[model samples]
Target: MDWVFLSELAINGALTGLLYSLFAIGLVLIYKASSVPNLAQGGLTMVGAYVVLALSHDAGLPLWLAIPLAAVIMFGLGFGIERVALRRLAGRPVIMILMLTLGLDIFLRGTTLAIWGGTSRSIELGVSYEPLFLGDLFISRIHLVGAGVAVALFVAFMLFFRTRTGIKLRAIADDYMASWSVGISVEHGVGLSWALASVVAVATGVIWGEIQGVDQALSLLLLKGLTVAVLGGLDSILGAIVAGIILGVIENVGAEFLDPLVGGGSRELIVAAVLILTVMIRPHGLFGRHDIERV
Candidate 1:
């Protein structure tokens, strides 16, 4: 009944949605460039968080130094994956490529578990965990910083797409042979995309780990990100951003008011139901492009 309470929830949902946006954007970037569904995004994200954790906690590196180091490592990891696993498999069946990525994801998850074990560890991000109070409204600094960082990253991506190299990448995505004929290196473009996506994953992981700590279960969030990607469309960057925010708001609002009526856990159901309905109604998603081929 209180409007202020409702407003608070809305703000919270929107900011949290920005975090989801970061995840979804990483996905969209890969899908758009490679036409390969990268199931390894979550693993890449988890690696980023753990890298920071080790550097800051075990090795005693400052947060400032750890961030860029993590980013570079992640980028190299991504580029290597593309160069080694994906490059040889190009022009293969789409289903096979999908399977390869799924396999890669599983391998990464298993390797991560073997190396790090199942124990969860908290990392220091220098942000206070104490909740802020404002005349009956409560906010967390994590939400504010996460949202700001996400938006800043999104802006950076937008600007990157305006550059000359960005245009070439887009062109390659449109038609590979044409771009190749025009002197664009398909391998380089795809490799760069994977690298960029990995960087985004690292950033998202760091933000999320700061908020919720490092754990193996974090990779499960890839499912939620996939849902957001489906709602936004597989190839739509802008759609991913919008759909992430929408998902956050819907999930939060439903959880706040509808959970009691349903005996809880409606958040997952809401997202799943939206995905199902979207598939039945608009399979390509809100901003997805439809392709028509004439015989």
Candidate 2:
């Protein structure tokens, strides 16, 4: 084990971690505001990536314009999903809502496959930037930019949580009836949450697509995002971010160090093991609140 190899591995892990954090945060936002585990988040991310690719490659739009347009489309899709699929399920059983989201996930996957035709596409953002070389480690300019974007979004979310709208959303999450009594429109809050989640999804999609090209299989890759959310605590934004970073680091480290010993594909096994351990230790997740039943 060369020291230089270890250092490079660490840098790679950090980059991957930041990307995971971006994806996980969206899941946390949706869960926190709506109390529904949105299994369709990954599908939306795939759609965003494809939208950017189509706009940039097929329509000849610049990456800058295409990215924002993709986000806007995803926002509309999120709002529509909430309005059409989730709104009617208000006050319904949790299982029912979960199943509805599952259905929505299938629909989104089918829609993406139909539109994109199962082909993979790449985004050439023309970001001709060099890597920062640090002795034995190298970090790409694009990854640094992506990490900066993730950090900025995370900070922005933290700041937004202090605003009046954020307070109303939190109130609804805490007690929907109480929030409604205080004149907060629960439906509107949930819709806003979905919209915000969609924006996050788009951002994540763009970043990840830059790392790994956009493909119809992108929706299936959401299992990684789901794992992050579950391990971090479904309702904790900070927890989700932290958990995502940790998961990314672990996956990279496992692949780098243990893949030879485990005969390849050990990273996924490591993730599953970590998830199982976390669930056993803290079923509510790292930041989730434990429920207490009254007699």
Candidate 3:
């Protein structure tokens, strides 16, 4: 058992987990505000990445300029989805909303393919992908920076939600009918949640785009992000962070040890296993509140 090798895996896994947390936060915000798990998050993320790619690579805009511009575009897209497609179905069954999000996902994927032509392209962030050596252990620079940025954004959002507008959104999440009865604008809260989710999607897309090329395959991140969200709690932002770290570490360590026995590719399987176990053991997740209603 080489301690250095083990340490490297754990550290890298933690950093990667932060990235996973970023992916889950958008889903959390949407679910918290609207009780929708946002099945189209992956599509939103993939499309956001392509938008950035188009802006930077195709339009010759600088990467810094392109990222914020893409975020604005995605924000509008998310708000549009909520206002146009989701608003009318506000009081419908949860299953209906899920189906609609799935439809939106398919639509987004098709639109991206038609526009981007299914080509895998990279976004040059100008960040070194070189591994940083710390004694006998090594860490990826990209992962480190990505994780830092994620944490900062998460903290900012947490603070933002503490404001009056944020309180209105939280109130709506707590009791939609009650909030509406009290004159809180549920539509605006849900729309803002979707818009913020889209903005978050852009960040997730850019980081993941740098890690993996920007393409339709980027949508597959939905599974990984979903696993993290389920484990953390659909409505728990803090839980997302905690669950992401645990998932990252466990997946990395498990893959390192179990891959040898299973031939390989166990990392992907770990997510499914964790999600199943979480559902079986703690359906509301570690930090999620248990909803109780007396009929």
Among all candidates shown, the one with the greatest TM-score? 3
- Cα lDDT tens digits, model 1, 192-235, are 99999989988888889887778887787788888788888877
Task: At residue 236, give the lDDT of candidate 2.
Answer: 76
Clashing pairs in 2: none
lDDT of 3 at 17: 92
| Candidate No. with top lDDT | 3
| Model 2 per-residue lDDT tens digits across residues 70-163 | 8888888788877887788876777898898788778878988898787677777665567788775887777777777777888888888889
Go through the candidates in order and give the C-alpha RMSD of each one to the true structure.
Answer: 1.7, 1.9, 1.2
Q: Judge candidate 2 at residue 257 and give its lDDT.
A: 77
Clashing pairs in 1: none
Q: Which stretches of candidate 2 lie over 4 Å from their true place?
A: 128-130, 292-295
Candidate 1 versus the native: TM-score?
A: 0.94
Candidate 3 RMSD to the real structure: 1.2
Question: Which candidate do you rate higher for TM-score, 1 or 2?
Answer: 1
Model 3 misplaced stretches (Cα beyond 4 Å): 293-295
User: What would the TM-scores of all predictions be?
Assistant: 0.94, 0.93, 0.97
Q: C-alpha displacement of 85 in model 2, angstroms?
A: 1.2
lDDT of each: 0.83, 0.80, 0.90
lDDT of 3 by residue, 87-188 (tens): 888878889999999999999999999988888899889899778999988999989988887788789778988999888888887888999899998888
